[model samples]
Target: MLTGADGRYHWPLPPATYTLTAHCPEDGSGGGTGEVTGVVVTDGRESTADITVE
Candidate 1:
């Protein structure tokens, strides 16, 4: 999934562990790849994960 113009993304997933990844290509702009492992999503709650590309 891609993020909006506000640089934010969301996904509705079942309660479980997950890995989130983000990638930016070298299109003359900033380019990098970031990932977050072991993300925990729970029932009746919102989970937030942040990946910093370098």
Candidate 2:
């Protein structure tokens, strides 16, 4: 997991619109793959997001 400027856990991906996703660490939780979230950031702009680990 990655920490953002927002002080939240997330995954930093390529700067661009993406189908951001997060999944369980195979801890046998049905919450595998976090809720679908999306963010549209320019190639050279700032972007951030927070995701909850089930």
Candidate 1 per-residue lDDT over residues 1-54, each given as its tens digit: 889998898889999999988898788876899999999999989999988887
Model 2 lDDT, full chain set: 0.60
Instruction: Estimate TM-scores for all models.
Output: 0.83, 0.47
lDDT of each structure?
Answer: 0.90, 0.60
Residue pairs of candidate 1 with colliding backbone atoms = none
RMSD of each: 1.4, 4.4
What clash pairs does model 2 have?
Answer: 22-34, 23-33
RMSD of 2: 4.4
Task: Compute the lDDT of residue 20 as modeled in candidate 2.
Answer: 61
Worst 10 residues of 1 by lDDT: 21-30
